[model samples]
Target: MGPVANVHADTLLIVGDSLSAAHGIEREAGWVALLRERVGDAHEVVNASISGDTTSGGAARLPDLLERHSPDIVLLELGGNDGLRGLSPQQMKLNLRTMIEKSQAADARVLLLGIEIPPNYGAAYTDAFRGVFRQLSEEYAVPLVPFILDGVALQDDMMQEDGIHPNAAAQPTILDNVWEKLGPMLSRDTDRNE
Candidate 1:
Protein backbone atom coordinates (compact mmCIF):
# COMPACT_ATOMS: atom_id res chain seq x y z
CA MET A 1 0.00 0.00 0.00
CA GLY A 2 1.36 3.41 0.99
CA PRO A 3 4.47 3.92 3.08
CA VAL A 4 5.29 0.84 5.11
CA ALA A 5 4.79 2.28 8.53
CA ASN A 6 7.97 4.10 9.62
CA VAL A 7 10.25 2.86 6.85
CA HIS A 8 12.86 5.41 5.85
CA ALA A 9 12.53 6.26 2.19
CA ASP A 10 15.20 5.48 -0.38
CA THR A 11 15.93 7.94 -3.18
CA LEU A 12 15.46 6.30 -6.61
CA LEU A 13 16.83 7.98 -9.71
CA ILE A 14 15.36 6.98 -13.07
CA VAL A 15 17.49 7.61 -16.18
CA GLY A 16 15.69 6.60 -19.35
CA ASP A 17 13.83 7.52 -22.56
CA SER A 18 10.19 8.25 -23.47
CA LEU A 19 8.89 5.14 -21.71
CA SER A 20 9.94 6.40 -18.35
CA ALA A 21 9.35 10.07 -19.25
CA ALA A 22 5.65 9.62 -20.00
CA HIS A 23 5.97 10.83 -23.57
CA GLY A 24 2.38 10.90 -24.89
CA ILE A 25 0.61 10.64 -21.56
CA GLU A 26 0.04 13.05 -18.71
CA ARG A 27 3.06 13.21 -16.42
CA GLU A 28 1.03 12.12 -13.43
CA ALA A 29 -0.36 9.17 -15.37
CA GLY A 30 3.07 7.71 -16.12
CA TRP A 31 4.61 4.70 -14.42
CA VAL A 32 7.19 6.72 -12.53
CA ALA A 33 4.44 8.74 -10.91
CA LEU A 34 2.54 5.56 -10.18
CA LEU A 35 5.71 4.17 -8.62
CA ARG A 36 5.84 7.12 -6.25
CA GLU A 37 2.26 6.40 -5.28
CA ARG A 38 2.98 2.68 -4.92
CA VAL A 39 6.01 3.16 -2.73
CA GLY A 40 4.56 6.23 -1.11
CA ASP A 41 6.81 7.46 1.69
CA ALA A 42 8.94 4.35 1.33
CA HIS A 43 10.77 5.76 -1.69
CA GLU A 44 11.51 8.97 -3.56
CA VAL A 45 11.58 8.71 -7.38
CA VAL A 46 13.69 11.25 -9.23
CA ASN A 47 12.76 10.86 -12.89
CA ALA A 48 15.41 12.04 -15.27
CA SER A 49 13.99 10.31 -18.34
CA ILE A 50 13.93 12.31 -21.57
CA SER A 51 11.73 11.44 -24.54
CA GLY A 52 14.58 10.75 -27.00
CA ASP A 53 17.44 9.88 -24.71
CA THR A 54 19.99 7.25 -25.79
CA THR A 55 22.50 5.10 -23.99
CA SER A 56 25.34 7.49 -24.81
CA GLY A 57 23.38 10.48 -23.60
CA GLY A 58 22.50 8.66 -20.39
CA ALA A 59 26.09 7.62 -19.82
CA ALA A 60 27.28 11.19 -20.29
CA ARG A 61 24.63 12.61 -17.97
CA LEU A 62 24.81 9.88 -15.32
CA PRO A 63 27.71 11.31 -13.42
CA ASP A 64 25.79 14.50 -12.85
CA LEU A 65 22.64 12.67 -11.86
CA LEU A 66 24.51 10.37 -9.50
CA GLU A 67 26.12 13.36 -7.82
CA ARG A 68 22.90 15.29 -7.63
CA HIS A 69 20.61 12.60 -6.28
CA SER A 70 22.98 10.21 -4.52
CA PRO A 71 20.12 7.79 -4.91
CA ASP A 72 20.02 4.46 -3.16
CA ILE A 73 18.70 2.93 -6.37
CA VAL A 74 19.41 3.96 -9.95
CA LEU A 75 16.98 2.72 -12.60
CA LEU A 76 18.61 2.44 -16.02
CA GLU A 77 16.12 2.53 -18.90
CA LEU A 78 18.11 3.74 -21.87
CA GLY A 79 19.04 1.89 -25.14
CA GLY A 80 15.58 1.80 -26.72
CA ASN A 81 16.26 5.02 -28.56
CA ASP A 82 19.65 3.70 -29.48
CA GLY A 83 18.09 0.61 -31.00
CA LEU A 84 15.57 2.73 -32.87
CA ARG A 85 18.45 4.74 -34.26
CA GLY A 86 20.31 1.58 -35.34
CA LEU A 87 23.26 2.35 -33.13
CA SER A 88 26.06 -0.13 -32.63
CA PRO A 89 25.23 -2.63 -29.89
CA GLN A 90 28.86 -2.71 -28.83
CA GLN A 91 28.86 1.02 -28.28
CA MET A 92 25.49 0.75 -26.61
CA LYS A 93 26.83 -1.93 -24.29
CA LEU A 94 29.84 0.23 -23.49
CA ASN A 95 27.65 3.19 -22.69
CA LEU A 96 25.32 1.10 -20.53
CA ARG A 97 28.28 -0.48 -18.78
CA THR A 98 29.73 2.94 -18.11
CA MET A 99 26.53 4.15 -16.54
CA ILE A 100 26.22 1.00 -14.45
CA GLU A 101 29.82 1.22 -13.32
CA LYS A 102 29.51 4.88 -12.54
CA SER A 103 26.33 4.48 -10.53
CA GLN A 104 27.74 1.53 -8.59
CA ALA A 105 30.89 3.53 -7.96
CA ALA A 106 28.71 6.25 -6.50
CA ASP A 107 27.33 3.66 -4.07
CA ALA A 108 23.92 3.50 -5.74
CA ARG A 109 22.45 0.11 -6.53
CA VAL A 110 21.51 -0.15 -10.19
CA LEU A 111 18.38 -1.68 -11.67
CA LEU A 112 18.82 -2.09 -15.42
CA LEU A 113 15.57 -2.07 -17.39
CA GLY A 114 15.75 -4.50 -20.29
CA ILE A 115 14.20 -3.21 -23.51
CA GLU A 116 13.49 -4.93 -26.83
CA ILE A 117 12.81 -3.25 -30.10
CA PRO A 118 10.33 -4.48 -32.70
CA PRO A 119 11.34 -7.56 -34.71
CA ASN A 120 11.60 -5.45 -37.83
CA TYR A 121 14.97 -4.33 -36.57
CA GLY A 122 16.25 -7.80 -37.61
CA ALA A 123 16.73 -10.72 -35.24
CA ALA A 124 20.47 -10.35 -34.80
CA TYR A 125 20.51 -6.66 -34.07
CA THR A 126 17.46 -6.59 -31.82
CA ASP A 127 18.73 -9.61 -29.91
CA ALA A 128 22.08 -7.99 -29.31
CA PHE A 129 20.53 -4.76 -28.16
CA ARG A 130 18.41 -6.69 -25.70
CA GLY A 131 21.37 -8.74 -24.56
CA VAL A 132 23.39 -5.73 -23.49
CA PHE A 133 21.29 -5.17 -20.37
CA ARG A 134 21.63 -8.77 -19.30
CA GLN A 135 25.35 -8.78 -19.85
CA LEU A 136 25.82 -5.55 -17.98
CA SER A 137 23.62 -6.67 -15.11
CA GLU A 138 25.54 -9.91 -14.72
CA GLU A 139 28.86 -8.13 -14.88
CA TYR A 140 27.81 -5.58 -12.31
CA ALA A 141 25.70 -7.83 -10.12
CA VAL A 142 22.78 -5.43 -10.53
CA PRO A 143 19.10 -6.25 -10.37
CA LEU A 144 17.13 -5.81 -13.57
CA VAL A 145 13.58 -5.23 -14.75
CA PRO A 146 13.53 -7.92 -17.47
CA PHE A 147 11.12 -5.94 -19.59
CA ILE A 148 9.81 -2.69 -18.20
CA LEU A 149 6.83 -2.70 -20.59
CA ASP A 150 6.26 -6.45 -20.67
CA GLY A 151 2.50 -6.68 -20.45
CA VAL A 152 1.92 -3.20 -21.83
CA ALA A 153 4.00 -3.22 -24.99
CA LEU A 154 2.26 -6.01 -26.91
CA GLN A 155 -1.33 -4.81 -26.50
CA ASP A 156 -2.42 -2.40 -29.21
CA ASP A 157 -4.66 -0.46 -26.86
CA MET A 158 -1.95 -0.33 -24.24
CA MET A 159 0.37 1.58 -26.54
CA GLN A 160 0.06 5.15 -27.71
CA GLU A 161 -0.88 6.16 -31.27
CA ASP A 162 2.76 5.94 -32.33
CA GLY A 163 2.86 2.41 -30.97
CA ILE A 164 6.16 3.22 -29.32
CA HIS A 165 5.11 4.45 -25.91
CA PRO A 166 2.63 2.91 -23.53
CA ASN A 167 -0.78 4.48 -23.00
CA ALA A 168 -1.95 5.87 -19.67
CA ALA A 169 -3.93 2.74 -18.90
CA ALA A 170 -0.76 0.69 -19.06
CA GLN A 171 1.07 2.65 -16.41
CA PRO A 172 -0.03 0.36 -13.64
CA THR A 173 1.17 -2.70 -15.54
CA ILE A 174 4.52 -1.07 -16.08
CA LEU A 175 4.76 -0.30 -12.40
CA ASP A 176 3.88 -3.87 -11.56
CA ASN A 177 6.69 -5.21 -13.72
CA VAL A 178 9.23 -2.97 -12.10
CA TRP A 179 7.87 -3.51 -8.64
CA GLU A 180 8.22 -7.28 -8.96
CA LYS A 181 11.98 -6.98 -8.69
CA LEU A 182 12.41 -3.53 -7.17
CA GLY A 183 10.02 -4.04 -4.27
CA PRO A 184 12.05 -6.95 -2.97
CA MET A 185 15.23 -4.87 -3.02
CA LEU A 186 13.57 -2.06 -1.12
CA SER A 187 11.96 -4.44 1.33
CA ARG A 188 15.21 -6.29 2.02
CA ASP A 189 17.16 -3.09 2.38
CA THR A 190 14.50 -1.55 4.58
CA ASP A 191 14.42 -4.68 6.71
CA ARG A 192 18.18 -4.61 7.21
CA ASN A 193 18.13 -0.91 8.04
CA GLU A 194 15.40 -1.25 10.59
Candidate 2:
Protein backbone atom coordinates (compact mmCIF):
# COMPACT_ATOMS: atom_id res chain seq x y z
CA MET A 1 0.00 0.00 0.00
CA GLY A 2 1.27 3.47 -0.85
CA PRO A 3 0.91 6.35 1.64
CA VAL A 4 -2.63 6.86 2.91
CA ALA A 5 -4.36 9.81 1.34
CA ASN A 6 -5.26 12.74 3.55
CA VAL A 7 -8.56 13.73 1.99
CA HIS A 8 -9.50 16.29 4.60
CA ALA A 9 -6.13 18.00 5.04
CA ASP A 10 -8.18 21.19 4.72
CA THR A 11 -11.34 20.44 6.65
CA LEU A 12 -14.99 21.32 6.31
CA LEU A 13 -16.86 20.59 9.50
CA ILE A 14 -20.37 19.09 9.25
CA VAL A 15 -22.53 19.70 12.30
CA GLY A 16 -25.86 17.87 12.30
CA ASP A 17 -28.15 15.07 13.53
CA SER A 18 -29.06 11.52 12.48
CA LEU A 19 -29.85 12.50 8.91
CA SER A 20 -26.36 13.94 8.60
CA ALA A 21 -24.99 11.09 10.64
CA ALA A 22 -26.01 8.68 7.88
CA HIS A 23 -27.99 6.69 10.52
CA GLY A 24 -28.62 3.19 9.13
CA ILE A 25 -26.27 3.51 6.19
CA GLU A 26 -22.55 2.98 6.27
CA ARG A 27 -20.57 6.18 6.88
CA GLU A 28 -19.12 6.09 3.37
CA ALA A 29 -22.58 6.20 1.73
CA GLY A 30 -23.83 9.32 3.46
CA TRP A 31 -24.20 12.68 1.70
CA VAL A 32 -21.10 13.98 3.48
CA ALA A 33 -19.19 11.04 2.06
CA LEU A 34 -20.55 11.81 -1.37
CA LEU A 35 -19.40 15.40 -0.90
CA ARG A 36 -15.93 14.18 -0.07
CA GLU A 37 -15.94 12.13 -3.24
CA ARG A 38 -17.15 15.06 -5.31
CA VAL A 39 -14.77 17.58 -3.76
CA GLY A 40 -11.88 15.19 -4.45
CA ASP A 41 -8.40 16.50 -3.63
CA ALA A 42 -9.55 20.02 -3.03
CA HIS A 43 -10.97 19.62 0.51
CA GLU A 44 -11.41 17.41 3.53
CA VAL A 45 -14.79 16.82 5.23
CA VAL A 46 -14.93 16.42 8.99
CA ASN A 47 -18.32 15.01 9.93
CA ALA A 48 -19.37 15.84 13.45
CA SER A 49 -22.92 14.55 13.00
CA ILE A 50 -24.38 12.43 15.78
CA SER A 51 -27.47 10.22 15.60
CA GLY A 52 -30.52 11.55 17.50
CA ASP A 53 -28.76 14.88 18.07
CA THR A 54 -30.79 18.10 18.05
CA THR A 55 -29.93 21.69 17.25
CA SER A 56 -29.19 22.38 20.89
CA GLY A 57 -26.91 19.40 21.04
CA GLY A 58 -25.04 20.60 17.99
CA ALA A 59 -24.81 24.11 19.40
CA ALA A 60 -23.23 22.83 22.57
CA ARG A 61 -20.63 20.84 20.66
CA LEU A 62 -19.72 23.52 18.15
CA PRO A 63 -17.18 25.48 20.18
CA ASP A 64 -14.68 22.70 20.75
CA LEU A 65 -14.90 21.44 17.19
CA LEU A 66 -14.47 24.94 15.82
CA GLU A 67 -11.41 25.49 17.98
CA ARG A 68 -9.93 22.14 17.03
CA HIS A 69 -10.49 21.99 13.28
CA SER A 70 -10.71 25.68 12.41
CA PRO A 71 -12.52 24.61 9.29
CA ASP A 72 -12.73 26.74 6.17
CA ILE A 73 -16.45 26.02 5.88
CA VAL A 74 -19.24 24.46 7.89
CA LEU A 75 -22.27 22.47 6.71
CA LEU A 76 -24.81 23.14 9.44
CA GLU A 77 -27.59 20.50 9.32
CA LEU A 78 -29.61 20.41 12.53
CA GLY A 79 -33.18 21.02 13.77
CA GLY A 80 -34.68 17.79 12.38
CA ASN A 81 -34.43 16.05 15.73
CA ASP A 82 -35.87 19.13 17.39
CA GLY A 83 -38.86 18.94 15.07
CA LEU A 84 -39.25 15.19 15.60
CA ARG A 85 -39.25 15.64 19.37
CA GLY A 86 -41.84 18.41 19.10
CA LEU A 87 -39.55 21.00 20.62
CA SER A 88 -40.61 24.63 20.35
CA PRO A 89 -39.64 26.06 16.98
CA GLN A 90 -38.35 29.21 18.66
CA GLN A 91 -35.87 27.21 20.70
CA MET A 92 -34.73 25.37 17.63
CA LYS A 93 -34.22 28.63 15.82
CA LEU A 94 -32.27 30.06 18.72
CA ASN A 95 -30.01 27.01 18.78
CA LEU A 96 -29.39 27.20 15.08
CA ARG A 97 -28.78 30.92 15.24
CA THR A 98 -26.26 30.45 17.99
CA MET A 99 -24.42 27.88 15.91
CA ILE A 100 -24.39 30.03 12.78
CA GLU A 101 -23.15 33.07 14.67
CA LYS A 102 -20.46 31.08 16.38
CA SER A 103 -19.21 29.75 13.07
CA GLN A 104 -19.10 33.24 11.63
CA ALA A 105 -17.27 34.51 14.68
CA ALA A 106 -14.70 31.82 14.04
CA ASP A 107 -14.41 33.07 10.47
CA ALA A 108 -15.81 29.92 8.94
CA ARG A 109 -18.20 30.21 6.01
CA VAL A 110 -21.50 28.42 6.68
CA LEU A 111 -24.01 26.57 4.54
CA LEU A 112 -27.22 26.01 6.48
CA LEU A 113 -29.19 22.93 5.47
CA GLY A 114 -32.93 23.31 5.98
CA ILE A 115 -35.23 20.47 7.04
CA GLU A 116 -38.98 19.82 6.84
CA ILE A 117 -41.34 17.84 9.04
CA PRO A 118 -44.07 15.41 7.98
CA PRO A 119 -47.44 16.84 7.01
CA ASN A 120 -49.12 15.16 9.95
CA TYR A 121 -47.41 17.63 12.26
CA GLY A 122 -49.96 20.25 11.15
CA ALA A 123 -49.32 22.93 8.57
CA ALA A 124 -48.76 25.73 11.04
CA TYR A 125 -46.02 23.96 12.99
CA THR A 126 -44.47 22.56 9.84
CA ASP A 127 -44.38 25.98 8.24
CA ALA A 128 -42.89 27.58 11.32
CA PHE A 129 -40.22 24.91 11.59
CA ARG A 130 -39.39 25.16 7.92
CA GLY A 131 -39.34 28.94 8.08
CA VAL A 132 -36.69 29.03 10.81
CA PHE A 133 -33.92 28.25 8.35
CA ARG A 134 -34.94 30.95 5.93
CA GLN A 135 -35.10 33.47 8.75
CA LEU A 136 -31.69 32.50 10.05
CA SER A 137 -30.11 32.49 6.63
CA GLU A 138 -31.43 35.96 5.93
CA GLU A 139 -30.50 37.25 9.36
CA TYR A 140 -26.96 35.92 9.17
CA ALA A 141 -26.56 36.55 5.47
CA VAL A 142 -25.52 32.95 4.99
CA PRO A 143 -26.28 30.64 2.09
CA LEU A 144 -29.01 28.05 2.70
CA VAL A 145 -30.39 24.99 1.01
CA PRO A 146 -34.18 24.98 1.36
CA PHE A 147 -34.33 21.25 2.01
CA ILE A 148 -31.58 18.76 2.79
CA LEU A 149 -33.55 15.68 1.82
CA ASP A 150 -34.80 17.24 -1.41
CA GLY A 151 -35.57 14.38 -3.82
CA VAL A 152 -35.04 11.66 -1.24
CA ALA A 153 -37.52 12.46 1.53
CA LEU A 154 -40.79 11.41 -0.09
CA GLN A 155 -39.44 8.53 -2.11
CA ASP A 156 -39.97 5.15 -0.50
CA ASP A 157 -37.13 3.45 -2.29
CA MET A 158 -34.71 6.30 -1.64
CA MET A 159 -35.20 6.03 2.10
CA GLN A 160 -34.41 3.27 4.56
CA GLU A 161 -37.01 1.27 6.54
CA ASP A 162 -37.26 4.15 9.03
CA GLY A 163 -38.47 6.40 6.20
CA ILE A 164 -36.69 9.27 7.86
CA HIS A 165 -33.09 8.75 6.69
CA PRO A 166 -32.09 8.38 3.07
CA ASN A 167 -30.71 5.18 1.65
CA ALA A 168 -27.24 4.97 0.05
CA ALA A 169 -28.80 5.11 -3.40
CA ALA A 170 -30.22 8.52 -2.58
CA GLN A 171 -26.94 10.12 -1.51
CA PRO A 172 -25.92 11.25 -4.98
CA THR A 173 -29.15 13.19 -5.42
CA ILE A 174 -28.69 14.71 -1.99
CA LEU A 175 -25.15 15.65 -2.96
CA ASP A 176 -26.49 17.29 -6.09
CA ASN A 177 -28.98 19.32 -4.09
CA VAL A 178 -26.30 20.42 -1.65
CA TRP A 179 -23.78 21.05 -4.41
CA GLU A 180 -26.16 23.29 -6.29
CA LYS A 181 -25.62 25.95 -3.61
CA LEU A 182 -22.49 24.77 -1.84
CA GLY A 183 -20.46 24.37 -5.00
CA PRO A 184 -20.28 28.10 -5.54
CA MET A 185 -18.95 28.67 -2.04
CA LEU A 186 -16.26 26.05 -2.55
CA SER A 187 -15.29 27.40 -5.93
CA ARG A 188 -14.31 30.71 -4.42
CA ASP A 189 -11.22 30.26 -2.28
CA THR A 190 -11.97 32.79 0.43
CA ASP A 191 -8.86 33.46 2.43
CA ARG A 192 -9.45 32.36 6.01
CA ASN A 193 -6.94 34.98 7.17
CA GLU A 194 -8.96 37.85 5.81
Candidate 3:
Protein backbone atom coordinates (compact mmCIF):
# COMPACT_ATOMS: atom_id res chain seq x y z
CA MET A 1 0.00 0.00 0.00
CA GLY A 2 1.06 3.58 -0.62
CA PRO A 3 1.23 6.45 1.81
CA VAL A 4 -1.93 7.89 3.23
CA ALA A 5 -2.77 11.03 1.26
CA ASN A 6 -1.39 14.16 2.90
CA VAL A 7 -0.44 12.30 6.07
CA HIS A 8 2.97 12.81 7.54
CA ALA A 9 5.15 9.75 7.66
CA ASP A 10 6.45 8.18 10.87
CA THR A 11 9.94 6.84 11.32
CA LEU A 12 10.20 3.14 12.23
CA LEU A 13 13.49 1.97 13.69
CA ILE A 14 14.22 -1.76 13.68
CA VAL A 15 16.74 -3.14 16.17
CA GLY A 16 17.25 -6.85 15.58
CA ASP A 17 19.72 -9.66 14.94
CA SER A 18 20.70 -11.71 11.87
CA LEU A 19 17.06 -12.40 11.13
CA SER A 20 16.48 -8.76 10.40
CA ALA A 21 20.03 -8.22 9.13
CA ALA A 22 19.38 -10.35 6.03
CA HIS A 23 22.24 -12.66 6.79
CA GLY A 24 23.47 -14.82 3.87
CA ILE A 25 21.17 -13.02 1.47
CA GLU A 26 20.96 -9.88 -0.57
CA ARG A 27 20.19 -6.90 1.66
CA GLU A 28 17.31 -5.78 -0.55
CA ALA A 29 15.72 -9.20 -0.24
CA GLY A 30 15.36 -9.03 3.53
CA TRP A 31 12.00 -8.74 5.28
CA VAL A 32 12.83 -5.24 6.53
CA ALA A 33 13.27 -4.09 2.95
CA LEU A 34 9.93 -5.65 2.10
CA LEU A 35 8.45 -3.74 5.02
CA ARG A 36 9.84 -0.51 3.52
CA GLU A 37 8.05 -1.31 0.30
CA ARG A 38 4.86 -2.25 2.11
CA VAL A 39 4.65 0.96 4.06
CA GLY A 40 5.70 3.06 1.08
CA ASP A 41 5.89 6.76 1.97
CA ALA A 42 3.74 6.22 5.02
CA HIS A 43 6.81 5.63 7.17
CA GLU A 44 10.57 5.65 7.08
CA VAL A 45 12.03 2.23 7.96
CA VAL A 46 15.48 2.23 9.49
CA ASN A 47 17.18 -1.17 9.57
CA ALA A 48 19.75 -1.27 12.38
CA SER A 49 19.95 -5.04 12.67
CA ILE A 50 23.34 -6.67 13.21
CA SER A 51 24.29 -10.23 12.41
CA GLY A 52 24.64 -12.39 15.57
CA ASP A 53 23.47 -9.64 17.87
CA THR A 54 21.83 -10.60 21.14
CA THR A 55 19.41 -8.90 23.49
CA SER A 56 22.26 -7.52 25.55
CA GLY A 57 23.78 -5.96 22.46
CA GLY A 58 20.46 -4.49 21.44
CA ALA A 59 19.98 -3.06 24.90
CA ALA A 60 23.36 -1.40 24.78
CA ARG A 61 22.90 0.02 21.27
CA LEU A 62 19.27 1.14 21.58
CA PRO A 63 19.97 4.45 23.21
CA ASP A 64 22.11 5.49 20.28
CA LEU A 65 19.59 4.30 17.72
CA LEU A 66 16.75 6.00 19.52
CA GLU A 67 18.63 9.28 19.64
CA ARG A 68 19.70 9.01 16.02
CA HIS A 69 16.31 8.10 14.55
CA SER A 70 13.79 9.49 17.02
CA PRO A 71 11.46 6.97 15.46
CA ASP A 72 7.76 6.97 16.03
CA ILE A 73 7.88 3.19 16.22
CA VAL A 74 10.68 1.00 17.50
CA LEU A 75 10.63 -2.67 16.51
CA LEU A 76 12.42 -5.03 18.89
CA GLU A 77 13.55 -8.31 17.28
CA LEU A 78 16.37 -9.44 19.52
CA GLY A 79 16.52 -12.45 21.90
CA GLY A 80 16.64 -15.16 19.20
CA ASN A 81 20.41 -15.14 19.18
CA ASP A 82 20.34 -15.03 22.97
CA GLY A 83 18.19 -18.14 23.02
CA LEU A 84 20.44 -19.86 20.49
CA ARG A 85 23.38 -19.13 22.72
CA GLY A 86 21.60 -20.66 25.71
CA LEU A 87 21.62 -17.39 27.58
CA SER A 88 19.48 -17.08 30.67
CA PRO A 89 15.88 -16.21 29.77
CA GLN A 90 15.65 -13.99 32.81
CA GLN A 91 18.58 -11.91 31.63
CA MET A 92 17.07 -11.78 28.14
CA LYS A 93 13.84 -10.50 29.64
CA LEU A 94 15.73 -7.89 31.60
CA ASN A 95 17.52 -6.73 28.48
CA LEU A 96 14.26 -6.61 26.53
CA ARG A 97 12.52 -4.81 29.34
CA THR A 98 15.33 -2.30 29.42
CA MET A 99 14.98 -1.66 25.71
CA ILE A 100 11.22 -1.32 25.97
CA GLU A 101 11.44 1.05 28.88
CA LYS A 102 14.07 3.15 27.15
CA SER A 103 12.03 3.38 23.95
CA GLN A 104 8.91 4.36 25.84
CA ALA A 105 10.87 6.92 27.80
CA ALA A 106 11.95 8.42 24.51
CA ASP A 107 8.28 8.53 23.46
CA ALA A 108 8.54 5.97 20.69
CA ARG A 109 5.84 3.34 20.48
CA VAL A 110 7.38 -0.11 20.68
CA LEU A 111 6.51 -3.30 18.80
CA LEU A 112 7.97 -6.56 20.07
CA LEU A 113 8.67 -9.16 17.41
CA GLY A 114 8.37 -12.48 19.19
CA ILE A 115 10.81 -15.27 18.36
CA GLU A 116 10.73 -19.04 18.94
CA ILE A 117 13.87 -21.13 19.05
CA PRO A 118 14.16 -24.79 18.02
CA PRO A 119 12.87 -27.39 20.47
CA ASN A 120 16.43 -28.65 20.86
CA TYR A 121 16.86 -25.93 23.44
CA GLY A 122 14.58 -27.93 25.74
CA ALA A 123 10.98 -27.17 26.66
CA ALA A 124 11.82 -25.39 29.89
CA TYR A 125 14.27 -22.91 28.38
CA THR A 126 12.55 -22.41 25.02
CA ASP A 127 9.20 -21.78 26.67
CA ALA A 128 10.69 -19.15 28.93
CA PHE A 129 12.46 -17.44 26.06
CA ARG A 130 9.28 -17.35 24.02
CA GLY A 131 7.28 -16.04 26.93
CA VAL A 132 9.53 -13.01 27.48
CA PHE A 133 8.10 -11.11 24.54
CA ARG A 134 4.56 -11.83 25.62
CA GLN A 135 5.22 -10.87 29.18
CA LEU A 136 6.91 -7.63 28.19
CA SER A 137 4.19 -6.71 25.72
CA GLU A 138 1.45 -7.24 28.27
CA GLU A 139 3.38 -5.48 31.00
CA TYR A 140 4.25 -2.49 28.83
CA ALA A 141 1.07 -2.26 26.74
CA VAL A 142 2.90 -2.62 23.46
CA PRO A 143 1.88 -4.49 20.33
CA LEU A 144 3.63 -7.71 19.39
CA VAL A 145 4.08 -9.74 16.23
CA PRO A 146 3.84 -13.23 17.66
CA PHE A 147 6.61 -15.17 15.94
CA ILE A 148 7.86 -12.88 13.20
CA LEU A 149 8.71 -15.86 10.99
CA ASP A 150 5.39 -17.59 11.59
CA GLY A 151 4.50 -18.87 8.13
CA VAL A 152 8.02 -18.85 6.75
CA ALA A 153 10.20 -20.75 9.22
CA LEU A 154 8.46 -24.12 9.05
CA GLN A 155 8.72 -24.27 5.27
CA ASP A 156 12.02 -25.62 3.97
CA ASP A 157 11.92 -23.55 0.81
CA MET A 158 11.25 -20.37 2.72
CA MET A 159 14.43 -20.70 4.75
CA GLN A 160 18.06 -20.48 3.77
CA GLU A 161 20.39 -23.47 3.80
CA ASP A 162 21.24 -22.93 7.45
CA GLY A 163 17.50 -23.08 8.30
CA ILE A 164 17.94 -20.17 10.69
CA HIS A 165 17.28 -17.25 8.41
CA PRO A 166 14.41 -16.79 6.01
CA ASN A 167 15.20 -16.47 2.31
CA ALA A 168 14.06 -13.77 -0.10
CA ALA A 169 10.93 -15.66 -1.03
CA ALA A 170 9.89 -15.60 2.61
CA GLN A 171 10.31 -11.88 3.06
CA PRO A 172 6.78 -11.00 2.05
CA THR A 173 5.29 -13.52 4.41
CA ILE A 174 7.32 -12.16 7.28
CA LEU A 175 6.20 -8.65 6.45
CA ASP A 176 2.59 -9.84 6.44
CA ASN A 177 3.04 -11.17 9.95
CA VAL A 178 4.44 -7.84 11.15
CA TRP A 179 1.80 -5.93 9.25
CA GLU A 180 -0.96 -7.66 11.16
CA LYS A 181 -0.09 -5.74 14.30
CA LEU A 182 1.72 -2.81 12.71
CA GLY A 183 -1.14 -1.80 10.47
CA PRO A 184 -3.32 -1.03 13.43
CA MET A 185 -0.57 0.97 15.07
CA LEU A 186 -0.10 3.00 11.92
CA SER A 187 -3.81 3.64 11.69
CA ARG A 188 -4.01 4.75 15.26
CA ASP A 189 -0.94 6.94 14.93
CA THR A 190 -2.26 8.54 11.77
CA ASP A 191 -5.63 9.11 13.35
CA ARG A 192 -4.07 10.67 16.41
CA ASN A 193 -1.96 13.02 14.33
CA GLU A 194 -4.97 14.17 12.37
- Provide the clash count, candidate 1: 0
Candidate 3 per-residue lDDT, tens place, 1-194, comes to 97556557799999999989999889998889988988888799999999999999999999999999999899999988898889999999999999999999999999999999999989999889889989999999999997999998879999988989898899889888998998999999888988
Please list the residue runs of candidate 3 whose C-alpha ends up more than 4 Å from where it truly belongs after superposition. Answer: 1-7
Predicted model with the maximum lDDT: 3
The lDDT per prediction is: 0.89, 0.89, 0.92
- Model 1 has an lDDT value of 0.89
Distance from true location, Cα of 101 in model 1, Å: 0.6
For model 2, the superposed segments whose C-alpha errors exceed 4 Å read: 1-10, 190-194
Model 1 lDDT per residue over 1-194, tens place: 77455545689999999999999889999999999988887778899999999999999999989988889999999988998999999999999888888988898888989998999989999888888888888888888887888988879989988888899999999999998889888889878897
The 10-residue segment of model 1 with minimum total lDDT is: 1-10
Best-to-worst lDDT order: 3, 1, 2
The true-versus-predicted C-alpha distance at residue 86 of model 1, in Å, is 0.3
Write candidate 2's Cα lDDT for 69-138 as tens digits.
Answer: 9998899999888999999999999999899889999999899999999999999999999999999999
Extract clashing residue pairs from model 3.
none
As a TM-score, model 3 comes out at: 0.94
Clashes of 2: 1
Clashes of 3: 0
- Report lDDT (Cα) of residue 43, candidate 2: 86
- Shift of residue 9 alpha carbon in model 1, Å: 2.4
